[model samples]
Target: DVKVTQSSRYLVKRTGEKVFLECVQDMDHENMFWYRQDPGLGLRLIYFSYDVKMKEKGDIPEGYSVSREKKERFSLILESASTNQTSMYLCASSLLGLWATEQYFGPGTRLTVT
Candidate 1:
């Protein structure tokens, strides 16, 4: 079975502290994505990598960055945590080159920056 695992299910941090969220997929997928979900804005893509070491900035990348060192692992870094950045962060992985391929999502990490 294909599985995606997240390092944390919840996180609490003070403003200005750096945070790291990790994800790993058991499936050998080529596309990995990081997204943040807000109440009004919905799910907004933060970053993605189609291949190892090749990352693309997404819609909201101002305070976020991503690293994909291996095919199955992707990491999201919050440069400096802030109250506005508090949201549920989701990580997903999908197979490449398939029109209908569904992305396998990890249980989101709910981060609260006070």
Candidate 2:
């Protein structure tokens, strides 16, 4: 069975601290995405990668970045954490092309920046 996992289910960080959220997929997917979910804003994309070492900015990429050095691993980095950055971080993976519609998601990490 395919699985996507997040490094943490919940995280707490102080403002101005550097934060790293990790996600891994065992499905050998060709695409990975990072999204932040808030109450009213819904799911806002932060970053996405179509291939290793290649990434693209998404809707809300100001305080975030991503790395996909290896096919199975994708990492989301918060350059400097802030209270406004607190949200539920979701990681998803999908096959490239037409199969991209079927995405597998991790449990998600709820991060609180104080």
Candidate 3:
């Protein structure tokens, strides 16, 4: 089955610490993305990779970046976690960013930086 799994369901960290969230997909999708989801704010892209070792900053890339070392794995890293940065992190994957492509999302990771 095609699925994506996140490394954590919830996270709590002190302010100013580095944080890492991992994601993995099993469908060999070529596109992977990291997004932040907040109530009534919708999903905002953090970063994405179209292929292994190919990364691009998305709309909301500040303080966050991504790594795609393998076709099926993508990782989101917060350079330094902050209270204002606390939000739900979602990982997603798509076969390709074609006209009819649909992204599949992971369960999500709720992060709290205090």
lDDT of 2 by residue, 1-114 (tens): 779999999999999999999999998899999999999888888999999999999988998888999999999999999999989999999999974598888999999999
Question: Residue 82 CA error for candidate 3 (Å)?
Answer: 0.6
How do the predictions measure up, each by TM-score?
0.96, 0.97, 0.96
Candidate 1 residue 87 C-alpha distance from true site, Å: 0.3
lDDT string, candidate 1, 78-106, tens digits: 98999999899999999999694788899
TM-score of model number 3: 0.96
TM-score of 2: 0.97
> How many clashes would you count in candidate 2?
0
Higher-scoring candidate on TM-score, 2 or 3: 2
How high is the CA lDDT of each candidate model? 0.94, 0.94, 0.93
Query: Total clashing residue pairs per candidate?
Result: 0, 0, 0
Using TM-score as the measure, the top candidate is: 2
Residue pairs whose backbone atoms clash in candidate 2:
none
Question: How much lDDT does candidate 2 score?
Answer: 0.94
Question: In candidate 3, what residue range of length 10 has the lowest lDDT sum?
Answer: 93-102
